[model samples]
Target: MITTAMRTRASIVPLLLALGCPQDGGTASEGGPGTSDGTSAGTDTTVPTTSAGTSSSGPDDPTGDTGDTGDTGEPPGEPSGNDLDQNALFTCRDQPALPPADLRLLDRYEWTRNVGSWLSSDLANNPLYPRPEHRYSTYSDDEALDPSVLGLYLDSVGGAADSWTIGKWDGGRLRTVHEDPECQCFLYDAAPTSECVRYFVRRYLEFGALFRPASEAQFDALLAFTEGVLAGAPDVESRPAVIKRLGAAAWMSTGALHRPELGAGEPDEHGRLQLGDWELANAIAYALTRTPAGVPSVNRSYNAGFSKGDVDGDLGSILDAARDGTIKDPEVVAKLVEEHIGGIDEARLDLLFEPHDERYWETHSEYWMAHGVREFFREWLDYGELAAQTPKVEVAATSAWSGYAVENSYQNQIVGFYGYESTLDYQLDDMIARILDTDQDVFANLLTSRMFYTPATAGYQENETSIWKSTAEANRVYNVSGITPQTREGRWIELPQNERAGVLTHPAWLGAHALSFENDPNLVHRGKWIREELLCQNVPDLPITVDAKLSEASKSQSARQRMSEQIDADPYCAGCHALMNPLGYPFEIYNHAGFVRVEDHGGPPDGTSNLVGMPSPELDGPVTSAIDFSQRLANSRYAKRCFMRQTFRYFAGREETMHDACTMVAIEKAYDDSGGSFTEMLIALFNSDSFQTRVPD
Candidate 1:
């Protein structure tokens, strides 16, 4: 837990700013210190100059040799491939241990992606105008998994192996099957029937025996076997042919095999299809394993010449008969339908369906519909279970704060309920409202008293009247009558003992500041601002390890002088500051007013500045574009971890402490397990013991 003294000290300046009552006689517009050069004073030293002549090798250039080890200091040898020491691929040990809950969370993220892909495959080539593209829009059944529907979809799209191709097809032709190179063996001539059986079997084995819920050794063995099979050369002429032959041969039997003969298909009065027992068995097995050649089996009709309505009516009747016991066994009903339905020609099926009409069929009866149903059922089940097992943590309704406001005169869209005259004023008002609405007594009290209006102490001007009014409202509402006049001195200041406790409230304004100043290139800056203001984390002073030689030699200094110097000077400071500074520097464009300013103190107004001394020297240049900054921020290690931690806190609804290492570890692990989704982390946190249980104070 953070110390009270630190919280008090941090709360004073912000509280005064929040009160709309400034001690300084000057108006808010006449704010102190609009901009600082951000340079440190140091003694000058003579440095050698280098010519601007082009060279094959430059100080910042990467060595082109494959054998070049660079400065990583890693051993120059092939990594061991053994499971105990699998150094070739990135192992979990190489990185910090993520929470186990994070793994489950990541799985949820991947599951969503998988479901999205499934939905896309179902909706591709759909005829419906403005067809739903996302999974939420299509194929949700809200029930148990409809294996039959899923199987039909898999058959039409050629299973997961052909998901990419399936995704390319429009909804108009969902039933229209295409011969995919990936699954050519399952649809082509000279493709043995046994090969189709083996292909499905292999898929099942891979999914069930090799993936999660299976042991690592089992996974390794399966992978090894697959690799061996792929590496081996067979007698087939082409790679596809080899794959087909291997698939076929794996399931073929050399001895005498029992074959079933097809009978003239007509049902008796009892509605049972006139099929031999052996024939029925064969058809059942085929339905389970055989890949459809052209159209999906669901849309295929045994009686193709019949009217469209009649064909649909017949299917409905058949299904109804099976349900009502008029057809007795489902297997019998299935057999009768198969015989009556004319088998679609694999090659000609695509030609029969109009591309424009296919979307309706998919929407009405496809995997997307089924998936939606499944999701609904899962949610229902989970909700019931949660209600029964866990006590709900009640959070009061809070004001929504709109961070930064872009002055879009054309759009008059209002977000938060707090109505201020201007966008900036509205944002500040919204922040004050959120602080007032906090459910925690300590947090609420702190925000209301010493920490409410202190934007200026943290280097922001609180000249806006709308901001001041909201702060006064919060103070009155929370009944903090005795807040000392001395506490309202600066934009940021420490709170007195009678004012407040807890670190969350002191950082609330900082959090608002960070959000208000957010821009793509300024992500690092936002992060640094958050760290300094909210968490009160100490950021070390800048060092001087930059390319002094280059800067001293050239009349025009290199763009990365400030960043490079700090990184190169002290190795101890290099790691943390390097991580923090670049992330913060990107947000240099946001000034004290919480408005986007394209210029730094001495640079161009377009916020195209760059940081030097990064892991890659090639990236050391002026970041003149938002894309460059966004990519750097998104890919930063600290940004990723901080995001994870914030998500954890939001869902867990509590401060993390050293004693909660196991929970933290579990949460981080879960994030890694899941594919890093905010939603997944939420679910994992909700399902965690820390979230479910109430700890005694």
Candidate 2:
């Protein structure tokens, strides 16, 4: 029976045909001679000619003979046959148990951001973007692009082609950095001839794939596929329009979609696979910034002079460094990091928060975080979830007036009686920004720093003061004592030391870790976060037969009192809960809404818990409250090492094997040497063998 799926597959047959791949025993009308596996027979994708006197096919290949050349008077540069790697490009190739090369697919965010930067349009809301299914990081190298996902990719690119116009093409893109006359036709509005198409396709591969030279086979297949597209297009469409469509097709190819961390050439004597110039450039840029090396962005505004003018967003200098091999130096990499890693100036930060300007691609939320430094903390701390799924917050009038001195009458009335969980994401972001600008003890500061941005102080840089004030007042749960609507000077303020410590103690983090839509603390989840993320310890999953539900909350007992009876009483539950509950119970000083609780149910809340079996003996005993816990965690070497590991996982897009131990040790030393500067650790990490080299299977 004919199905919708069948019809969808049938519709794109022509475009696939244009790719010059044919099924086994396929007819010539399908685009080319068919191999048994439906792949091209050779490695060259350039169209070949039947000229008998043709001496050689270029430097990579020295064979004087051309294959099965028919005297069609075609161009002499084309290779013998359609030579694309069908398995790698068209299907999910079987990965080796330990693959020789490290190839990570560009996550949906990276793809959307890159495409948006290239096109200079906002594509963040594009429905075609496939979000990462993982619970933590947005990217995962372990995931593969299967057949179903490939179909989505094909549809996405095809849709992009349909919507694209000639005017949208950025003609000036990569032109200054790439001065090759033959390759200048990339997204050009002018009509390119048959001969110019090959050069155009090659350039597309090079730029789209982040300067990695396309293989001869890939070049030949793409060239023929592009020609087929042009020849077969309806006369209703203009040549430039057709070329744009073809450009979209090439943009979504395997070479463009997946980033190659395979490094250059073969393994060395020590079995190290050092990244090539282009590969290294791409790795550095992606690790620090969301975009590739040569893309125009404020992050790449380095002082290195290039023939192309050194504009704010111009990254031509980086491309030049890669080409000249200066980027291979560790000092150069460190310099680039130092130059790019910084906070936005007040003027620009104000502008970013202002109404959107059509001239810029960056948004208020994204502009200030160009280097993704803030984002790293956001994910690592996992606090952003509060904004996504806010839990209910209710603050009484007496508490609001006495605790935060609710001065605003409207706020007092609204907040004193009732409140909802206001998203404190912006507040946390601002706090991180302030600390990063200081650029000292990044990890330590994140854990134990009392300085923060309340709504009253949010507007000076990010222009979020008034909004934050209203929200905080409405929530009536402002735990910080000095912050009020009237204190709107827009400066960072320190909370009372006894009340708060670090990001974990922040209201946002507390609210995010709370049980969904409840005023109750999520004991297991909070404990698990500490166990896995901070301590680098793993908790066993609950057995299938176990009913993990806790007894209902009541006015008779406190949260800790109620939870302990169920979790600690059971032998099996206690076995795992012992690792997590003690770590989590310290946070009970604050309610689910992040309000400092004077009383829970009927009595003073017990926030005390014992930390046992910790890798660091100093951190093994203890714990009075969240503040005390934060102080201990801030000083723990074990915690810092775990943070470094998390950082490695985040940037490398995968879990570290034993091979990464040296890198970890080096990063630790660098962190200590720089007095715990996160930036210095990153520099050390980027230059480390684990980051720069790969292992061959």
Candidate 3:
């Protein structure tokens, strides 16, 4: 069957690809043409690239000859196909392994996204999800569940279940579900003649609860409850009884609230407990993305329409097909790598194109990259406080925005959130995706590439629009070295140089890491993020007795001047501050307001920066600016391994430990072998024993 998604995409594919991928007006391939079998799917998904990640020169190639492959040693015009192999200079070594932890319990973000998939619709568009508090981190669910959080989940889940059954209770839905079901909602609604509701409930419980259907015991118990609900019903049409039963299961059931993947049976030949289909599905989705199982892969939005014919509901279909060997003999173990984990389709590749406000794509392209990292950058960079970003702090002599405070919430908004957007957030996020998706040397593209998107009028002196944050007050000054603004409200891609190379200079990272009125960038925080997140090294937490604060006397000097003098004066604070201050001072190129500047209110900016404490022989030591640091970082083996290490912790939801050493080595190898494909690194992790094995209950 041409899936509903495929049918819809058949017509719009050309338009979407043309907008972003200049090389993809023709039928394209996914993850390039180098599949395990080395055969192409021949789907109109991506512009096929050579094994080295360069666009293929074919009759349909829309992006013409990429100039010269000459010396100067850049990977031709395609520029490393996302610059995947940027770390070719570093010597490969066995790196420290990542630790795997029991990934139990649904994080709040996962819970909400999964709920929408089970029901096969975007409930957020209907204004159904209740946000008790803003979510900054995916791990917030690891903490003790709050009463308000539980309440929010209960209400939203119930609403979703009710919405599905209510919309489908009429004739043909039951047949539509059983003949060829879409998601669990249709599967539940397919129950014929109330007598078989128990059998269907068992199936859904297995699917939605994140548990195995080892016995009929749980199904029998739930059936008893359904019989009780039906007993209160009037006569023949006991549909209300079924809906109520499904709703209850969707909320109160174990799988509904927790990620319970109990150990099942004998150890595989590898000694890892073989996870069941449901467990595998849940884990795979959690590792790669938090989007609901059945959600479309791209152009998704709150207002995006929901159709009943879609088959992307849960992991059951893919896993079941693999086991039965129905289509091609799928090693389900490797299926996790090839299809879901490693592979890319046209939908995702299309997200690279900015819509220009005319195409009305359903979702943004960058969500794929964001979801891949277990650590959400919004929380990591502290941009979750986007709502609090205001015009209160006037940037010094920074054009019209110097005194005018504009807080444009329409930055780059993700689709499912209740009508929110931000260009600065999206700009950085899209850059991350472009890097990970395009090439090897993934870190090279991630750190050193200077491309970014921004409003055409970001630097314009005049503005009129007003919304959550006054657009006029919020119109950002385009002060980065490499970018040039293209439109008033839309984003255009621009590549910058020097300190503009990586996310360190992106507005989202800069804005989130800065102080409100301190105006000077927080060197300590910036340095800390680099040391921990990027370099994968831990600086000891400060002592409780020690309060490292800038004295009033010190505050008058420029941030650099004050910081340098203060650190020099205090022997105790100097130890940790040394790790962060020097590394962070490079970003003094931009103010805490996220606009570029040569100096701060305090002192002249220090143009020189360094990769302090980096253990890599090639990457460590002095650098000139953020751009220089980004280039060195991309070239560092230590930094690249740490990045992959971060990728593992994010998906596995654990810290790196000795137990995970061997598997982490496999991941490191994949990064090197795949020429820096971030997708390859993820595939290696998912396919490893650490991701598949669980601790026995």
Tell me, by TM-score, which candidate is best.
2
- Compared with the true structure, model 3 gives a TM-score of 0.69
Taking every candidate in turn, the Cα RMSD to the unseen true structure, in Å, is 32.2, 13.1, 16.3
Return the top candidate by lDDT: 2
Q: What is the lDDT of candidate 1?
A: 0.27
Per-candidate TM equals: 0.23, 0.72, 0.69
User: Which of the predicted structures, 1 or 2, would earn the higher lDDT when compared with the native?
Assistant: 2
lDDT of 3 by residue, 546-647 (tens): 866777876556777777777745888888787777778777776665666655563555657655455567866787777777677777777777676666
Better of 2 and 3 by lDDT: 2
Q: Is candidate 1 or candidate 3 better by TM-score?
A: 3
Angstrom error of the Cα, residue 263, model 1: value is 69
Give me candidate 2's TM-score against the actual structure: 0.72
What alpha-carbon RMSD in Å does predicted model 1 have with respect to the real structure?
Answer: 32.2
In model 1, the runs with Cα more than 4 Å from the true position are: 1-527, 530-583, 598-603, 606-622, 625-627, 650-676, 689-697
